[model samples]
Target chain A: MNIYLRLVYRNIRANLDRASLFFELIFPLFFIFVQGFGLNGIVPPFDVGNGRVISYSLFLAAGAVTLTVINGGTNAGTQLWFDRKNGMFEQLLMGPFTRAQYILSIIFATLIIGVAGSLLVFGFAFPVLGASFAPTWEGALLIAGALFLGTMFFGAFAIALSVVLKSSETFQIVSTFAFFIFLFTSSVFFPASAAPSAIQAASLANPLTYTTDIFRAGLFNAVTPTVSLELGVLAIEAVAMFVIAVFAFRRIRV
Target chain B: MLMAPDQVVRVDELSRHFGDKIAVDRVSFDIARSEVFGFLGPNGAGKTTTIKMLTTLLPSTSGRATVLGHDLKTEGRKIRAQIGVVQQQDSFDQGLNVETSMDLYGLIWNVPKAERRRRIDELIGHFEMQEFRKMPTVDLSAGQRRRLQVAREFIHDMDLLFLDEPTVGLDPIVRRSVLDYLKERVRQGLTIFFTTHILEEAEYLCNRIAVINQGRIVQIDTPENLKRRFGSAKAVEFKLLQGTSSEMASALSSSASVSRFGRDEGSGAYRVTTTRPESVIPEIYRLADRLNLTVSSIYISETTLEDAFINLVTEDEKAVANGGRAS
Candidate 1:
């Protein structure tokens, strides 16, 4: 287990150049600002019970943070595809560790990056959008929980697809498809009620929807649907995906 | 004779097949404690496949194997704890600097912070990596990266080590230094299993070698014994005086001293194979003197490992060809 942790640490440290604050965090932060504040004039306001200008910017900010987790997890798994092509995966597989350990290390590193990126986005979003965070410490815990479980679920899914896919190009295609699916189907852009009945049903089935729903609830203390329902859905998805990913990785032929 | 229980590695009929293609066929060998065993073979000869099995990377298709007496299938994690591996390719984390890279590997092995720091410092100097210790691995040269790969494996005192073509693609001086370092570790009781196609490396480093071809072990013996058994005997070649007839070649072939004689098809030169070339040379000179044939040039060829390898492989090929023809 210590070896596995060390491996995770090494991957994060080694990839520092690829982890530029400007590109990954700052750029996404700016995009969230433009989508939130800049679009308020052209885009019509969302109707809430009170006649206050509904800050879609805050909603978009939270969505961006969730998207960052998805991006981080997908990129981490795709990097393994590059390693496999270069024979580095073969080398690691032949080393002392089991395949399960290898996958865990990758997932751990992705989780760190995802959570860190999400937190940074949260810090930037709070000030720019003038959106107040939950005053209670429970909100912070919920945010952390969302990042941790969400990244692991997506990270495991990416790893499973990576082992089955033949090349990075294919992984990229699948990732793009997954991103759009999660982005549109989940509560990233709009509330589940705004979607069609069929779309809402599909969104409820998506693990990302539950994760995003819970995170939004924690940030705004606004419950669109039952908060517990989304949390429960995410928990089951996280556990099931983790098991499948570990098993799929173990059965992979070096 | 009773074998000791402390053998570093024991393989029994280890085979791995990919679908219908048998990549590693029923190959079995063992390494005694502190011995440097060389797995020598040409490309596509199952060296990597066998190494993968030994290192617990791939499951064997049949048979049983163990490392440090722990079953490869059951106790892989424990076996992994007791061994170090240097793969053929450089696999250092490209995102980390050399120091961080080593630190992470040490951390994974659960080394204490103080011990890890001391070992990192010692290894930096020992591997001549002090200058590049702060530089990311992506910035290092091939040789520098290879040094880090080898150094990373030595952070812990492992009982067994696997080096898969560790020195492939390095200059002669660097290759020698790496091999020497491995030998030094072997002297300190580290059992090493390394794969290489360089025969001279096997000759200099290995206590015993297994020559593999087409997924099978063609021969397994000490270098000296293999040289003696399959190595070519001395041979003498002479250019016959212009117009030396085919009849003369036939006559020379029947000589008691000459095992076989043939003429070069293009040059019409006479080549003689003999067990005792020193005595046979005198006989050839005498025959030439009586026949009044002028010898234009004479050359003798010495035996080498390359000759022994070619002879062994060709002998097998010849037997296969003959069987095919008979069938």
Candidate 2:
């Protein structure tokens, strides 16, 4: 077996804990169920500025899928923190592999986790929430591309983060901070049109908003403005994060 | 044997710096194949820093080193592939059990499956970890975990092994077992770079020992030669029935063989450090009898490795105090 593959497998398997399950599966599903049933039609009907009346649950489910991408990236970055606390970093640095290879393994493993997790949430949402949704070929392609690029972008960000942060408490703060900021700015709970002007502006610049747009367009068959532009931006961000992560990892002491 | 002359590790003027402070000075040495080279010093004596630099774990600030003829800087991966290290701290995959940890380590080192199983079984038995083979490594006792840590490295074949205080928290029997295990490996043509602050273990195991102090190699010689170089006086002890008196102090000070005399505060016994204990013993007896001092006990002891160790470190400290250092 390839050493890098073995390392990645070990990391992913090690992350199989109740907390990971709750964060990736149960936590998002809880939001989906509560919003899907509790607010399906109870509130006054409101239309987005574009004359599209989007349901709250569908919007939340799309956002929840993208949440998995962010979760996967942060979790992957924290794997290095655990390894450092346990002295495995020193042991591995002295082994046969280079530091870059070790960092890459974590990134790849987290990418797998993010993609699989988003797929799980996306596929299971229809039967669980009773939402009648199916994908056209173009919709499916955009969703897959967005999830892939978003996972890579966040995975790279997490690796670069793990390289600089020292304590787990601080890392938790940073990850939680990033997650909530991205969650609120993106169209997770409501369409950007329903949010205030400030949040709408924030969403315009947030990479996650573009990812959520791609997800929403595919899952609910909604029309996204300039779909190709979103794909290009996501691709560019993913490439930039990967290159920076690889560059920053070299400065970390053994 | 020291004469094997294979020179598996050759370090020249190696040094490491953390910020402005130098952790390891310009230290140089060589290790032959199949020899147990012990590095002895106290904590913070640069033993670990030097080991880290030589193992290619930490880059040196200034130096030239070659492990297996591969340069330390450019060929680190090649060197790492051929060497193994057991660091001072305990490291294990907490999620894996003892047996699985061994298997995974062997697997990471790219050992074949058949050989991995064979070595795992052999190491488990050899380290007396059979009962805890199925237990999680994080839950094992410190000594048991250490056994596993040291034994797991043997899963891979290597030309050189670096052990940094491998028996720090072990019992006497386990420590001896670890030493003997290392001895057997040395006999099988494995060169070991062992660091320990324990003088007795160094004496029992090392063929040639290097005494490091304040980030410098103060002395490098056989255990016997180290004692000969740093040791010149033996201890002669005398216990009197009563507390020490002015008369006994005067006699010891005027004796020809005795150079230093003092009463131990704890035992109230007297110690006379002398160059010639044979003549000093008779002189002590004659003085005690003449003064009507009831001598309870008297004994002459040779210099020990511990004594030699303390002396060497003290000399280096004094030299530093006097602003003298080795080139």
Candidate 3:
């Protein structure tokens, strides 16, 4: 097997546990099943722009996929901290592996989990919420791009954070705070246009907002000009975060 | 230039510094094929640092080294591919069981599936880890974890192996088993670069031992030769038939062969430190006859490698204290 694939396999096998299952599959289900339906009568249908209005369930389902990807990215970064703390960072480097291969393995593993978890959410959302699954070729390609770029961006950001922080306790605290901030200020729960002006501005500046927007457009088969702009911004952010992650990784002692 | 073909590792003037403080200072040594070269030192004595540099885990600050004919600076990956290292720190996935961990390590090295199973079985049996093979690593004891860490290295084939305190946190029986296993590997042409704080283990397993103090190699020789050279004084102890003996004390103090004399209160014996045990034993017998006291038991104890190691390190410390550098 190739070195990257070997490492990715190891990562997947090691990380597949009850906590991972709850985060990737169950947590998203709760939001789509409980929160999405619980607010159906009170919140009204979401206006996804381009004159398309969808039920609150469909909107939160799209956000669920992006949320799963975000969690996957966070797990990838958290894994790096654990590896360093447990001495496997030096152990792997002592083996027939380079720093590049090790970091890339994390990215690939996160990508796999992100795509798989998103599919599971979509599978469960359509059945439980009485929604339909139909997407044009363009919409499908857009969804693929959104998942890939979203996984790459968050994965790199988390990896960079993990390397910069010194202790695991600090990493957990900072990551939890960052995760809550990014989730709320973005379009994962509510549309930016429906929020206050300050939060609207914050959502516009947040990359998670772009990821959720692009994913929502693909799910509804509403690939508009705005989706193109969101995809472009996400691609740029992914590349930028990747470069920063590489720089941070170079500073690691072993 | 690379070392001769028989020399698996050649380190010359290799040093490592952390900002302003030096960890390994211009240490030079060569390990021949199938040789068990021991690095003996106290805590913070640079043994692990030297191992880290030689194994290509850490870069050196100055000088040069080569392992298995590959240059340390340029061909580190090549060297890493052909060598195995068991560091002082524990390295394993806590989620995986012992068998799975060993199997994963073999898979990382690209070993075949069937062969990985065979090596895992062999290592588990040799290291006496059969009972915990299915247990998660987080539940293992420290000694079991250390044993697992050392055993996992053998899953992949390598000509040279570096072990840093591999037997630490192990019971005497298990520690001896590990030493015997290492000896078997060395007999089969595996060269080992070993580091340890246990002088007895080094004396038992090392073909040649290097005593390091303050990041410097103070002495390097075979264990027997080390004892013979630095441990010249013999401890001659004799138990008197009579309990209290002021006459025997005076006789022992006035004798020229006895350099240092004291009574061992626990054993009810008189202990003497002397270079010439032959003359000292006879002088005790004659003194007993003149004092009208019967000689019960007497014996000469040989100096051990631990004694020699302390002597060398103590002298090195004194020398460094006087001149700010070890001789």
Candidate 4:
């Protein structure tokens, strides 16, 4: 096998434990079932920004799929922290692969997990949530684009953060704080359109909002020009984050 | 720059500084094929830093080096592909069992599957890891972890292998086994760059040893040459069948040949360090006779590499304190 492929396989194999399983699959399922069901009766159906309306479970299922992407990216980036602690970071760099290949393998592995997790959530929702499933070619492309761009952006951002932070304690604290802040400020749990003006403005400023918007729109076959516009903005953010990650990684001492 | 055909590593005045602190200063050396070159030093003595720079894990602040005929700066990837390094720090996947970890390391080196399986079995047996082969690496004892770490490095082929304190934490028997294993590899034409604080280990395995102090190379020579040059003072000791009087102590202490003298607390033997043990031994006999003390036994002990190493490093420290370079 190629060096990059070997590294990717190593990353995936090393991370396939119970803790990662909880974050990648079980955690998202909790949000989709418990939270989605608890609020189903009190909260009315959601418009989903298209003419058709959907149940609360169906609406939150899309957001839950996105939760998998976030978790996958976080796991991918924290892998670096673990490798550094265990001395594998220097060991791998001194192996056959270049620095670029090592970083790209990590990002690529997260992308694979993110897309697979999202598809699994989508499959679960189709039979369980009683949601309709039909889409144009463009709708499917928009969902694919959202998963790819969003995973890349978060993977790179977390990697950059891990490289800049000195200790694992600080990394965990900052990452958790950032996760909750991004979760509340974005359209992951609720519609930014229905939120107050302050939250809506903050949501608009978050790149994750654009990702969530594209994903939700595509899930309901509600493709619009705005979804494409959101995809464009996400692509730019992903590229920028990737550049920062590479720059920070190059400056690392070991 | 092209190295000689026999040279696997060639370092030229390489240095690394962290801000104002120099971690590795202007170090230069060469390792020929099939030679086990030992780097012996005390703690925090730039041994690991030098290994890191030579292994392509860290860049030097100045100067140059070539590993396997590839430049350290521009050709790090090429150099890395042909070399193996077992670092001082422990590195392995905690989630994987010992056998799996070895297999994964083989995979990283691009060793074929069938060969990886064959080597895994061989290493597990050779390193005596069968008792814990199925145990997770995180749960293994420090010695077991170290054995696995060293054993896994043999799974792949490399022209030059760098081992930074590889035998640390091993029991004496296991340490000897590991050293013997390395000797077998050396016989098969593998060049080794070994670092350790164990003087006996260096004396046993190294064809030539380099002693580093304060980020500088203090001395580099064969172990025998090192002992001959710096450890020339032999220890002369004589045990008295009868207790000694004050006169006998005074006579031995005032002798011209004996420079340092002390009594062994357990054996009641008078020990003296002298440049000329032959003269000192005869003088000790005369003093014993005049003092009416019976001399039971007398012998001259040989100097060791540990004595030479301490002598060199102590002299270097004293020279630095006096603002002079060590000779």
DockQ result, candidate 1:
0.45
Task: Write one digit per residue (lDDT tens) for candidate 1, span A1-254.
Answer: 46677667755655445645347677567758776677756666564222223567766677778877787778577657756764557656655577767777888888888888888888877786776544557656667778888998988888888888877788889877987888788877777778899889989788778778678767665554466676777878888988988877776666
Clashing pairs for model 1 are A3-B108, A14-B95, A14-B96, A15-B95
Give the Å error, residue B280, model 4.
5.2
For all candidates, state DockQ relative to the true structure.
0.45, 0.45, 0.62, 0.66
Candidate 4 C-alpha error for residue B117, in Å: 0.6
- The sequence of per-residue lDDT tens digits that candidate 3 reaches over residues B143-185 is 9999999999999999999999998999999999999999999
lDDT by residue (tens digit), candidate 3, A50-73: 667898878887897788888888
Better of 2 and 3 by lDDT: 3
Give per-residue CA lDDT, model 2, range A1-254, as digits (tens): 89888778777655345466566776677778886668867755444323546666666777878888888888777777777776777887888988878888888888888888888877887567666755689878888888888888888888788777778788889878987898898877777767899999998877788788887776666655777787888889889989998887777776
- Of 2 and 3, which scores higher on TM-score? 3
TM-score of each: 0.85, 0.87, 0.93, 0.93
How well is each residue in B181-212 modelled by candidate 4, as lDDT tens digits? 99999999999999998889999999999999
Residues B1-327 of candidate 1: C-alpha lDDT, one tens digit per residue: 123586778788888999999998888788899888888777888998888788887789998887888898989878877888888866877667899878877876778889999999988877778889999877988888888888888887789888888877778987787788788888988898988878788788988878877677778888788877888877888886755755557667887878888778787677899877887777767777777777778888877666777777777667666774221
- Which ranges in model 4 have alpha carbons more than 4 Å from their true place? B239-258, B261-270, B278-296
Estimate, for each residue in A29-121, the C-alpha lDDT of model 4 and write its tens digit: 888889999998988986776686888877888888887788777877778888888888888888888999999989988888888988887
The lowest-lDDT stretch of 10 consecutive residues in candidate 3 chain A is A14-23
